[model samples]
Structure formats: C-alpha cells, structure tokens
Target chain A: MIKVEWFYWLCGAIFIAVAALTFADGTNAKRYGSGAFWGLLGGAFIYSTFVVHKTAPASVLGLAVIMMALLVATGQLGRGDTTGPSRAEQEAGADRFGNRLFVPALTIPVVVIIFAVGLAKIHVGSEPLLEKSSETLIGLGVASIVAVIIGFVMLRPKSPLAPLSEGRRLLEAIGWAAVLPQMLATLGQLFVAAGVGKQVGRLTEHVLPSGSLFGGVLVYCVGMALFTIIMGNAFGAFPIMTAAIGYPVLVQHFHGNAAAVFAIGMLAGFCGTLCTPMAANFNIVPAALLEMKDKYGPIKAQIPTAIPLLACNVALMYFLAF
Target chain B: MLVLLGVLLVVIGFALRLNPLVVVTVAGIVTGFLGHLSVIAILNAFGNGFATSRSVTLFVLVLPVIGLIERFGLQEQGRRLIARLHALTTGRLLVLYLLIRQISSALGLASINGPAALVRPLIYPMAEGAAERRFGRAIPEAMREKVKGYSASADTVGQFFGEDIFVAIGSILLITGFVDTTYHLKLDALNVALWAIPTAICAYAIHGTRLFLLDRRLDRMAEAAGLTTRPDKADAQEAGR
Candidate 1:
C-alpha cells in the first residue's frame, strides 16, 4: 500500500529545490535568510521521514523549527526579485491559449476528486491502494504533480525550471505568513501538553451559574467561539469547551441533544475562525495571496458575517438542540 | 493555571503587533516551562507537532501549478469569460460561487476551490471583471479591495458551513467521536450532520444577503465616485432586462 510519506518526500524535494533556486538568484537582497528558511523547512520534511523510523531524534527537528522561527521573528526572510511572465506575454498567452489556460488549473481538483472520492477504496488482493489515513492529503500531492505535468505540456515554457522559479516568486510573496498555520497548529499541541485546556475548562466551570439551561447553553456556545478565536481552530477548542460546559451542564443537566449541541457548537467555533488572524490560513493567508494593502482585510470582511452567524448559532442551539 | 500565560502572551503579542513567529515561540516555551517540562522535552513537543502538521502546508505543492497558469494568463482568461457573460454583476457572481462552493463542499468536494487554487486565479478576476463592466472604468482601489474581501469570504463561509453537513467530514466525525467516547452517549454521526442543516441554511441566507448587499454597495460607490450620472436608471433598466 502506498503511504503519505512518499508524497511528503516529494514535497520536501520541491522545497529544497526552490531554496536552491533562491540561493542562486543574485537579485534577492536577503538571499541567505530566504534560502536558509526554505532550506530548513525542506530539511524538516526530509528529516521527518527518518524521525518516524526512530533513527533521528525529534528534538533535533524541534531545534530546527526554533531556528526557523527565529529566522522569521528576526525579519531575516525577504522576497526575491523573481518575476513571472510579463503582462504583455500573459495577455498574448491568454489570447493564444484562451480557456485552455483553465484546463491545467482545473485538473488539480478533478484529479483530487478522482483519487479522494472515486479511488479511495481501490485494492489489490485486499491491500488498499491508498493510505486510508491520509487519502485526501495524498490525493492533493498526486493532483499537484499531475497538474504541474499538464502545465508543462500546455504552457510549454522555454526553461524546464520555470515552474519552480514561478512557484518561488509566489511563495516569497506570501513569506512568513505561509508557515503561520503550521506554527499555530504546533502551538495548539503545546497548549494541550501543558494542560492549558484543563485549566481553561476549570475556569469556565467555576464561572458558570448553576442549573440555568439558557446560561449553560449560552456559555457553551460562546466559550467554543471564544476559545477557537484564541486557538485559531475549532478542533483545538472543541474538547475543552465540550468538557467544560457542553457535556456536564448542557447535555447532562439541561438534557440538550448531544448531536445538535455539539454539531452547532463546533459551527459556533467556526464563527470565531472567521474573526481571528490566528487562523492564518483562512484569514491572513488569503490577504497575502490577494496582495491586499491591509493584512487584516479578510478578517475585517468576515467579522460582519461572523458576528451575525455566531448569534445565529446561539439561537439555533437554543431552539433546536433540545 | 500559570500555564495559561501562553494564551495571555498570544493576546498581548498580537495586540502589540510583535512578530507572531517570535510571540508564538516564546509563548510555547514559557507555557511548557510553567508546565514543568524540560527544555529538551519542549523541543520534542514542538518538533513532533510541526512534523505531524506538515499537511497544512501541502498547499505549497500546488503553488507551482498556480504560478504557471497565472504566468500564462489564467486570470486574464477568467476575466474574459466573465466579461462575455455581460449580466454577471459582482454581487451576483459571488452569490453564484458561494452557492456552488457551499453545495459542492456539502457533497464532500471541499478541495475543489481555495484561495490559491481558484480565488486568486479565477474568482477574484471574474468578480473584478464584472465590476469593471458595471462601472465602465477601473474600479477605485478601495472598491477593488472590498471585492477581494468578499470573493475570499464567499469561499470561506461556503466551506465552513457546508463541510459540516457531510457526515464523513472531519468535524462530524470529531463531534461523534468526542461525545461517544467521553460520555458513552452512542451518538450517531448522521444526527450530528443532520443538525448542521439548519445552520447551513441560515449561513447561506445570512451570507447570501450580505453578498446581495455588496452589489448595492458597489453601485453606491460608483455613484459617489461620479462614475455614473444616472445610476438608478441604469440599474433599473438592467434589472428590467
């Protein structure tokens, strides 16, 4: 059976190659910082393979992560002067390629769907063809490779390295915010290990009033949203809020339906997902991707929607959960 | 309790606008120390989590394809397509995308659209194209910025609300697993997914209305910028047609 690790290695190779390209680009003002940052991230991916096999110590990987964070924290990373096909060329390509330009781009999702939904359960003599645990991620990795090959076939660049150079340009544009999601996920893990969730749960329990169903439900929904805002993900906040008030007070004391309460509760946390920059992939990364002047543009756009939706969640939980 | 200092640090750091990487690293270390872990143990925790979370950064792999198509005018093509449609106002286009994004995600094809894959390349350009068609000029930077926000918002709101309605999705599985294992409730994942429908409908209604309002907002901006002398008459004629 194929595993996700193979795809990770492929990804690592791409990053390392991009880093090398960055190092070679004489136009980049902070080439050393940019090179080391990408190079180190690439090494982490490659090193993860060994760490999984118990050969390399994970702490070493830990140290590498810190070094990387230091690089970003100290403002060492900078964008290179790499440019893509100019506007005139792009327009010419558009006129020449027309809608066919969409073909390679659209292939990504098509291939991912085919693998994730269509071929997830294929087997050879009862041995699964895909790694069941990470089928979606593996599908993404496969889809990316397939799309790149198609792009090469369709776009037919003069240089084989155009794809990497273009990708490096976009990645440099995103800069540190590109890695912020993973960093937040790491922080979530640290928060868990430190029993921070337990303390928060305790604090919530202490703060809640006794035996009022509305209070219980209200607090649980708000708590989920509040915690998610801080943690940057509902997944991190769910367990803590659930344990704090969701299970004991709402479900046990007030007799709310577990399915409705928890389901809507998780959605409530998503409202928080909209409001916070900590959910970097959802909030901050999009701004960077769009090259917006305001880094908080997406979050600001989302807050109007998030606040009302959060209120809707509260009302929905009250009316439907019971 | 002192370990909660990490959370405090995150809040203060963000408020003070420090480098998040620096803030997060410091907060994690301080939190671990308070929790009585050794320096090595803290490193191990950070490393272990970072390695496991590599999937989050898998988006990097798709960047090359995005970069390539973009270089070759994928966005320009999108703009041309929207321009040909003629009737697709900026608001109408986003609502259509939100509906498609939400429904497709509900059917478990959440990866079909994203900022890198679709929005930056296709949706935003198309939306902007529609706006340019409406105003008959280059949109002011502020209005262009608002369109960007809404375009990205459509994808996000659509994904967040729609993904939960699919039973096989992670949020449903997580809800069921947590409740069943912790409380011995034997909850059905379907019940959890079923409960998501009401909120899903509300999400569409609420956000869909905001998107509609976006069209009105754009028209008002166009009028204020003196881009249109007879904005209401033109809008009325367009609506009539």
Candidate 2:
C-alpha cells in the first residue's frame, strides 16, 4: 500500500518535467547548471514523497539542500531562456479573445480566495473540508487546479504541454524570487529558535522610555518598518520585531490588542517596502522592469504615500489596540 | 551571544549583495547549529519548510495559463478595450486599477496581477496607449517610464494595504497565532479585518490622489516639452527615436 501524496507528486512531476525540458532544449549557456539544479530538487521531492523510506527522508532532504548550496556556490543556477511572444502575436491573441480573455485571467484569484478562505469552517461529515489549520495552503493548491482548468477551457491551449512549458519559462524568469518567501521565513524561524528576538527585546527595553505605552507602540511599529526595510521582507521582519519589541512590550506589558498591533504593525513594515531598494521585488524590480530614468522612481513616488500610510497605521493601531 | 551572530551573517551577506540563496542558506545553517539543531536535522527542516510554504509560489500554477493568455492577446484585448473609452487618461486608468486591485486584494486575491504577469502585458500598455493619445504619437520613453511607475506602484499599494483587511491573510494569522500561543490572549480575526478598513480607505484616497494628479502632470510635462495629444508620426518618430 504505497500511500502517495497527490499534491507533492503533482508539484514534483512539474519540476521534473521542467528539468527535462531544460535539458532537452540545451539552448541556454547555463543549461547544464539549471537542469541539474531543477533535476536534483525534483528528484528530492519525488523520492521523499514516494519512497516512504522513513529513515532516508532526512538525509535525502539534507542532500537536496547541499545540492542547492553547491549550485549557489558555483553560480550554476543562472537563467537559461527568456524569449517571449512578439507584440504582433500578442495583439493578435487579444483580437481573437476580445473581451473574453479576462475569463481565465480572473479565474485564479477568485477561485483561490473562495477555496482558501471560504470553506475554512465547513464540515464534511466528521472532518472539515480542509484542515482547520493549513486551510489556506491547501486551498491555494485547489484554486490553482481550478484556474488551470478554467484556462484550458477559455484559452483552449493547442496542447496540454503548452501550459507546462509556459509555466517553466515564467518560473525560470521569476527564479529565486519564487521561493523567496519560504527561504526568508526559515531565517525568521532561525532567529526565534536562536533567541534573536529575546535579545532584541532586552535591548529595546533598555533603550526605550520605561513604562510609556506610546513609546512602546511607536518603537514596535517603527522597529518593524526599519527591520523589514533591511530584510526586504515584512514576513521575515515580523518574528524578529515581535520577539524584540512587538510581542513583549506591546502585547505583554502594555496588554495591547495583539490583532490590531500586529495587523497594523505589518502594514507599517510595508511602508518600508515602498521606501527601500532592499525590497527589490516590490520597489526596485518594478522600477528596473519599467526602465525608469530615475532608478528609484517608484520609491520617490511612493515616499509621500508610504509616510502618510505609516502615520495613519500607527495612529490607528494606537487608538484601536486599547 | 553566539546565536545573535546569525543576524550579523544576514546583514553582512545582504550588504555585500551576495546571491540571496547562498546568504540565507549560510545564515540558516549557522543559526540552526547555534540553536542546537544537528546538521541533518536542519536539512530536514529546510526540506519540510520548503515543501509546506511552497504555497506562496502556487501562483506559478497560474503562470502557464497567464502565459497562454498573453500569447493569445489578453493584453491586446486590454489595450483595445481601453482604446474604446475615448476619455480614459493614464491617471484615470491607474486610479481605476488601484481601486480594483485594492478591493480584490482585500478579498485575498493579491495574485490576480503582478509585474511580469499583468503590468507588463496589460496595464502598462493600456496606460501607454492613453499617453500616446495625448502625445499624438509614441510617448517619449521618459513619460512611458512614468506611466509604468504608476502602474506598478498601484499593485504594491493595493496589495500591501488591502491584504491585511482579509482576516485570514497570513500576516493577520501570524498575529493571531503569536498572541494565542505566547500570551494566552484570544483575538478576533474579524476585528482585525474591520479595523483594517479605514487604513485601506486612507491608502486608496492618498495614492489615488497621486495617481489622478499624475495624469495632469504628464499632460503638462508633455506640453512643456512641446508634445501634443494628436498623433503626429513625424514628430513622434523623431522624439521616440
């Protein structure tokens, strides 16, 4: 009885397919490097899920990380291909689809949200439709399937492989930014696991005006923003700031509303996203993509917006948290 | 202490602009070891964490579909649709998108559009079409760049402010989980979502103003440069080239 997890298998299948495509094409200068990179990751995923060799999972997983590390060390995972459709062809597509093109384009997010957030509390006999926890993650996968189906119906891609190949091209273009969230999050865990948060908390307490609620709130929000600006990710900054200043000072001593504090706290960090180049994905990438004369054009436009938003968030959190 | 050195590793690595993957892996290994996870254990954690959190990139699943759509002319359709609206200006277009993006993101649909997916193909072109309407030819690349900036920022503003309003969003969840686990304080996700409404509105109003004004600025700037809304190919050709 090999109980294979279908989801992992699907993802693993895609990775392996992409790896094969990379190897088959062999057009990119970094073709060998990227092919090996994807192949190893795909192999790790497939083996870990299917083999059910309980003892081997950890070591196998370890090897994948090492493989990735080597790829990074050797600079092997460079992108191979980036050619896309010309303007004439793309315009021709718009003429054909006309107004109907949005049908597929819009399907994904609508389906994702409905499945991710809509069915959270529903019961199917004994168990919930989704696990009470991890509903969002599971639902995201389902929504993707539904969207892909919708795409097939709407676009009627000439062949099934069309979408897979297109997916690979875009995935390669996105490259590391695709898995960035997971990578940064692991760092967050490490920070907490290593008590980085606790130490920051100590330093924060000493520097702050003692017993001042305003001080605490301001410090927490500002700290989160600053840290996120540095880290290039609000999610990464959340654990550290909460540990150092957010949780202990705002949530514990002052007994602020954790929901309001953190909800607004994260928004504050996003203001940093608008202001800093470190958040390349958000600020810099778009600027670079647009080929703006001022490289910081987006940031310049956003500063007025970010500052006002941050101020409002702080005031909102301060008043509401109590 | 020794554990805090992991922070230094991240800071230095990023400052040096090393490949982020390498930097984060090194930081993770150092932190894992310092935190007392064996090397093998750390690897297992990495593998599991990567697998589970892979949900964020589930947008990749949407990419192929998006690619196919783009291949077929979704962006061309977008421009065609925008062209039909005689009065549409660059600012108005961006402002409308900002509202739609924020509202959808509030509904937890941030992935509906992104730089590579939507802006490049659809939104930027529509905005450029509007700019072309005014400049009477191809807009100067500089004005084209401004339009692109506004188009991209709209998505960011919408997502950053709007996503938090969805109670089930990860940021809100992180907050709820932290409070319940550490302080034994139960918080309502709905309350967070509701409070987020005002901020969302404020963001819309604030950025919305800038976007609206951006069109006026573009028009004035174009005029300052002696450009016109009438498509004069001779002048346009010279300026564009």
Candidate 3:
C-alpha cells in the first residue's frame, strides 16, 4: 500500500544519493559516470511520475529538469577545459568543400517536403489539396521547387556538401533500419483499425478476475511492456495490444478512467524498450553509432536499471491507475 | 497479401543491398498496389508518413551540421579540451553525454542526433585524448574502440528512457489510443507518461554506473594482457638515447 507520495520521496532520495556519490568521487571520472547513471534513472522515475500528473506542456518542462540534472552530473555542461582542435585532426576533417553540414541540413527539408505533399494528397484531412488536377499539379510543383532549391544550395558542386559523396554509403549502411519506424507505425494503425484489438479484448475477458480493479491494472501495464519488447517500437505494439486488450476490456468493461489507464499503459511499454533490441532506435542505433565490439553494449548497460523501473511502473499503475 | 508482398520486397531489397530509398519506394508501391491503391495513392502514403512525423526528419538536417563541426576539428577540439582537464575521465564525459541525450529526448526533441552524429568524428577522439593524457600516453586501439562503444551506449539508454515521459510524443499518444480502445478502458496519455519516470531513472543510474566502471575494466584488461606501460617506457628510453 505504498502511496504515490512515498514513491516521489524515494525518487528524490535516489537523486540525492546520486549527487552525493558524484560529489564524493567527482574528481574520479569513472565514479562520477557511475553516479550520474544511477542518479538519472532515479530522477527520471520520480520526475516522470510528477509529469504524468501535470499537463502535456508541463511534462516537457519536467523532462528538461531531468536533462539539466543529468548534464550537471555528467560534467558536459559544467566547467571544464574547452580547447580547439589540433592542426592534423582539422586537416583530416576538412575537405575541398567548405564543410560537411550539407547532409543533415539537406535531409530535414527533403523529409519535410515529401511529407507535406503526401499528407495533402491522402485525403486524410477534410480538405484534399488534390481535389482538382490543377491543385494536385500545383502541390507537386511546390514540393519540387523546394526540393530543387534545397538540393542546389546544399549539393552545389563546390559547396561544402560536396564532401557528402559518402552519403550514399551511409544511407546504405542504415538501410532497412531507416524505414522500420514507418512500417511499424503503419502496422500498429492497421492492427487497431481492423478489429484485431477487439479480438484481443474478447480473449482477455474470460481469463482475468471479473472485477478485481488492481488485477486489471497489473495486466494492462505488464502486457504493454511485454508487447513493446516484441515489437521494438512501443508505438507499433500499442494499437494492437491496447485496442484489443486495454480499451474494450479494461476501460469499458471495468469502468476505468480512459486517460489514466492509457497513459500509464504506454509508460509500461517504454519499460520494455530498455531491455529489447527490437526497438532499433534504442538497441541497434547505439551499437551502430558506437561501433561497439559487442552489439549488446547498450542492452547490457540497460538491464539492471530497466528491470527495477519495470517493477516500479507496474506498482504505480496498480496503485495510481486503479 | 499486399502487406506480405510489401514485406517480401523489403526483405529482398535489403538482402540485395539495393539503394534503401529505392527499395522502400518499391516496397511501398507494391503494398499500395496489392491494397488496390492507385499510383498516386501509394505516393501520397509515403508523403503522409513523412509529413506527420516531420520531427523524425530533423536529424537529416543535424547530420550535415555535425559533419561540418567535425570537419573543423570538433573531435580534436574535444580531445584537447579533455586532456587539459586533469580531473576529467572518459566515464564522466560519457555520463554527461547520456544525461543531455536523455533529457532532450524526453522533451520530444528525440532528435538529439549530435552524439551519434558526432561520436565517430569527435567524441571518440576526444575520449582517446583524455585517456592518453591521464595514462601518460596514447591508449591502445582496442581500448579506444571500447570508449567509443560505451559513449554510444550511454546515448541510447538516456533517450530510450527519457522520451516516454512526454505525453505528446508519438509513442505516448500511440500507447494511449491503443490501450483505451483495446481494453475498453479509459486511460490517459499523462498516466502512461507519468509512470515512465521511474523507468527512466533506472536507465540513467544503471547505465551511468557502467560508464563509471568502464575505465577500470579497460585498465584491468590491458594489465592482464601484459602489454602495459613497458612498451611506452621502452619507446621513451630509445627516444632519449
């Protein structure tokens, strides 16, 4: 019967412990790293709980506090030596082109333009820009112009973007990973819209306690976590699992508050994210970015903290959601 | 069947190592066709996916900027900076990066691509420099690689745990909608995000600890290999002679 307030205090204590640990061994870089990691986890748990109670915008602010604390603990934003580059390293980084800023810069606009034109045409909105052939052409024309302008500026022969000849290779390396989110998101949407969620609801109804409110909350949260591990992106697994099990069964049948139940359920999904490699953004990207000798470097670091947090999340959902 | 076809195209394209854009485009087209969509419909879907998630594409813009910074000796600068800070260690630097990454992500700015974008060209070298300064010489290539590995891991842990706290985030919204409709329960996006806090905390602490111990582990491994400072001392003696 631990109250949410007690959980908050415990979270604060975790942060204090982390800060104390850092102060004790701040001079020792390794010890500080360890302290910051633990501190951040404890802080994130407590902070997120507070945020969940607040409005959406406020939650963002809360996240900012967590980031600031982390930054201070890690010593990145704090006082330290800020030196310039060596001549050799600079030369290596340099190219005949002005700089390598073209790739990321160009990527943003390209992605935007593509999205704009697509959204307009899908008729997903009330007003479809492509209602007439002329409008359709006009939309295409605008997108084309934007793309061309960005391409010209960023990819000019003598521009710094010129050195991005390796762009093709880099994209290739990222390969299917780049499209995974889109595919998964779509899959989630389809699962929800197709009555699959309803089917799952029917299946779960018979197995659980008829009116045990706590049991329902526990099932909802734990299920979401397990689904996230399987699907990688919590977003992907959310629709199918929630629609099938959460909505019709937990909220409607059991008479739970929609907002509290859904929000808490998603949080549970994220717990699974910490432990699984399916979430490429979480598991795969780190391995690729770090070029780690071991592909499991991120997962290995995540397990100890992820397990405890998962337990905490289940507890919160049971207590608070109910 | 359309979905299956689309899936097959993606698998084949990837296996063949075809240009990813082309492969995805082809897959999308196949999916659209199988689903009885017109050519325009397929294209529109592609555009729609990109538009709604415009934030995801922001990373593309950041990559070039990061490349530019790195080109100007960002990594070298980071290294020299770390070398001068006698108290700084590789573990501490990485922990700091993890915090920044996690916090930014939680705010729904999950596009904190700088570390992943800059690590290869900047952070890795900087870490190497710091190790060299502390140990009184350049670290071996294996150890240098290990530093790179840990730095990237830190970023992933931070972002993964942090981002779910934001209610408006696509992941949170998606989760909320799913749970409400499926379980026939009324759940709020805030509740899901609120519950995420503890998990994020756990992620930060556990990963932070690993980063802290990383240096000591490397040192032990290096010592066990019996390839420690003797080589450097020998090189110094030869230079002196």
Candidate 4:
C-alpha cells in the first residue's frame, strides 16, 4: 500500500532541488545561507521518513532543526532574483490559453476530491490502495504530481527545468516564512508534552467560581481560545480546557450537552487562531504567499471577524449547550 | 506556574518581534527543561513532533505545479475571467468563495482548497481583478493589501467553521472520543458534528456581511481617488478613451 512516507521523500527531493537551484544562482549574495537552509530542510524531510518508522535516531533530526534555526536567526537566509514571465508575456499567454489555463490549476481540487472520497477505501486484495492514516495527504501528493505533468503538457516550456526554477523562485519569495507552519506545529507538540496545558488547566479550574453556569461557559470558551492562541492549535487546547472546566464544571455540574459545548468551544479556539501569528499556517504563511507588504496583514484582517465570532460562540454555549 | 515560563517567553518574543523560529526553539527547550526532561528526551520530542507534523507543510508538493502554471499566466487568466464578469464585485466574489469553501469542507473535502493551491494563485487575483474593474483604475497599494487579507480570511473562516460539521473530521472524532472515554458518556460523533451547524451558519452571516461591506469600502476608496461616481461611467470612459 502507498503510504505518506513516499510523499515526504518526494518533498525532500523537491527541497533538495530547490537548494541546488539556490546554490546555482549567482545573483543572491546569501546563496550559501539560503541554500544551506533549504538543503538542511531537504535532509530533514528524508531523514524524517526513517525517523518516523523508528529506523533511525530522531536526535539527528532534532539537531538539524536547531541548525536550520541558527541559519535564519543569524540573517543568513535570503532570496535569489529568479523571476517569472514579463507582463507582456503573461498577457499573451493568458490570451493564447484563454480558459484552458484553468484546467491544470482546477484539476488539483477535483482530483483530490476524487481520491479522498472515492479511491480512499478501494483495496487490492486486502491491502488498502492509499494509506489509511493519511489518505488526504497522499491524495494531495498524487494530485500535485498529476497537475504538474498536465501543466507540462499544456505549457510546454523550452526547458524541462522550468518547474524547478519557477518553484525555486516562489520558494525564495516566501523565504523563511514557508517553514514557519511546521515549526509552529512542532512548538504545539512540545507545548503538549511539556504539560503546559496542565498548568493552565489548574489555573483556570482554581479561578472559576463553582456552580455558576454562565461563568463556567465563559471560562471554557475563553480558555479554549486563549490556550489555542498560546499553543497555536485548537486541537491541542481542547482536551485541557475540556478536562479543566468543560467536563467537571459545565457538563457535570450544569448538565450541558457535550456536543454543543465542545463543538462551539472548538470554534471559539479557531477565533484565537485568527488573531495569533503562532497559528502560522492559517495567518502568516498566507500573508507571505500573497506577497503582502505587512506580514501581519492577514491577522489584522481576521481580528474583526474573530472577535465577533468568538462572542457569538460564548453566547451559543450559554444559551444552547444546556 | 514556573513551567509556564515558555509561554511567557513566547508572548514576549513575539511582542518584541524576534525571529520566530529562534523564539520557538528556545521556548521549546526552556519549556522542556522546566518540565524536567533530559536533553535526549527533549531532542526526541522535537524530532518526533517535527516528523509527525509534516502533513501541515504538504503544500510544498503543489508548489512546482503552482509555480509552473503561474509562469504561464494562470493568475492573468483569473484576472481576465474576473474582468469579463463586470457585475461580480470583489465582496460578492469573495462571499461566493466563502460559501463554496464552507460547503465543500462540510462535505469532507477540506483538502481541496488552501493558501498555496487556491488562494494565492487563483482567489487573490480574481478578487484583485474585481477590485480593479470596479474602481476602473489601478487600486491603491493599501487596498490591494486589504484584498489579499480578505481573500485569506474568507478561506480561513470558511474552513475553520465548516469542516467540523462533517462527522468524519478529526475534530468531531476527538470530541466524541474524549467525552466517551473520559466521562464514560455515550456520545455520537454525528451528534457532535450536527451541533456545529449553528455556529457554521453564524460564521457565514458574520463574515459574509464583512465581505460585502468591503465592497462599499472599495467604492469609497474609488471616490476618494477622484474617479467617476458611477462605476459603469468609469468603465465606459476608460473604454471610450
């Protein structure tokens, strides 16, 4: 059965390719720094494939993470000047391709849907075709490869190296911000393993006044959001908040519906995600991807909606959860 | 309380605008140390966490395809398509995307859309194109930045609230599993998933209204730029000229 490991290998190869391209680019003054950063990331990806299976020691991967961090911390990472087509060429290409240009771009979502919903369960004599643990991620890997091939058939550039070069350009444009998501996810995990949640849970439980349902609901929703902001993911914050106040205070004392309280409570945590750069994937990465002048642009845009939605969540839990 | 020192470090580091990676690494180490973990154990946590979380960064795989198509003018095509549909304002277009993203995610199709795959390459251009067409001139840099922000916001809000209503989603399973195992309460995943609908609808109404208000903001920006009062006249004038 195809597993998620192969996809990591593919990404490792891609990162290596990007590193090679960076090394080859003479225009970037910090090419070595940038190249080393990507190269380290590439090695980590390949190395992680083994680490995940317990085939290798994880400490090496840990050491690599610190080294990559040092590279960025010291102002080593920088972008090359690799660019895409000129404005006139983009216009001409658009006119030439017309609606056809959308085919490969749109295929990603359509094919992901097909594989995720339909092909995920199919078996070849009892071995699942896709890895059960990560069918969606595997589907994403497959969809991207198919999309790139389709792009090649349609665009037909002079060099087969076009994809790598262009991908490198975009990668450099994103710079260190691209990896921030994974790094934050790592931070979230560390937060969990460090018992940070336990500390916070104890504090919240102490602070709450007993038998006040509104106070219980308010603290549960707000604590979930606050803890998620600290941890960078609602998933990490959920069990802590639930255990501290949700189960004992709200559900047991007030007889709140587990479904309504917890479901809306998670959404409340999402509100914190909108407001925090710690939730880098949803906020910071997008700002960088869109090439905005301010990295916090997405976060600023989200706060208005997040605040109101969070208030609504509090109201929903108070009135409906019981 | 002392174990929460890492949390305090994070808040201070971010407030001071230090390098996030460095801040995070230090914070993790300090947190681990306070939690009484050995060096090897800390390293193990770091490595294991990074490895397991690889799924978060899988958008890297799609980069080559996105980069290649972009070089061949995928964004230009999006712009041109939006330009031709003059009636679809930026707000209306984004509201439409919010609905699409929300509904599609509700059906267990969250993987189908994202910042790298859809928003940067397709949605941002279309929204920007709509803004430019509505204003009948190049939009100011600030307005363009706002457009980008709104585009990303729509995707986030839609995905965050919408995906929970799908019973198979991890969040629902987590809710059910935790409640059932911990409290010994028999909870159905469907029941948990179904409760998400009201908040989902509230998210749509709240964010959908914000998006539509964005159109009015753009109109005010256009008027401040001394463009024609009516967008149609501005369009006709640009064309006739």
Tell me, by lDDT, which candidate is best: 1
Please report, in order, the local distance difference test score of every candidate based on alpha carbons. Answer: 0.79, 0.70, 0.51, 0.78
Segments in model 2 whose C-alpha atoms lie over 4 Å from true places? A1-5, A43-59, A116-118, A209-214, A231-236, A247-263, A280-293, A319-322, B35-38, B44-48, B51-54, B84-94, B101-198, B213-241
Clashes of each: 0, 6, 63, 0
User: Least accurate stretch of 10 residues (summed lDDT) in model 4 chain B?
Assistant: B78-87
Q: Proportion of native contacts found in each model?
A: 0.62, 0.50, 0.20, 0.59
Q: Candidate order by DockQ, highest to lowest?
A: 1, 4, 2, 3
Score chain B of candidate 2 by TM-score: 0.66
Q: Lowest-lDDT window of 10 residues in candidate 1 chain A?
A: A177-186
Q: Give the DockQ (2 decimals) of all models.
A: 0.39, 0.35, 0.10, 0.36
Candidate 3 chain A least-lDDT 10 residues = A132-141
Deviating ranges (above 4 Å) for candidate 3: A1-194, A205-218, A253-264, A280-282, B1-87, B126-148, B166-168, B176-198, B213-241
Q: Model 2: clashing residue pairs?
A: A93-B72, A93-B73, A94-B73, B134-B229, B136-B230, B136-B231
Error of 3 at A58 (Å): 36
lDDT tens readout by residue for model 2, B108-193: 55654667666776778877877876676755777777787788888789888888875445566455544443344555555555
lDDT of 3 at A127: 51
Give the range where candidate 2 chain A is weakest over 10 consecutive residues by summed lDDT: A1-10
- Model 2, A10-100: lDDT tens per residue? 6667878888888877577787888888787667666655333454465566567567767867878767655766888877777667878
Count of clashes in candidate 4:
0
Evaluated against the true structure, the overall lDDT of model 1 is: 0.79
User: Positional deviation of A4 in candidate 1, in angstroms?
Assistant: 0.3
Docking class of 2: acceptable
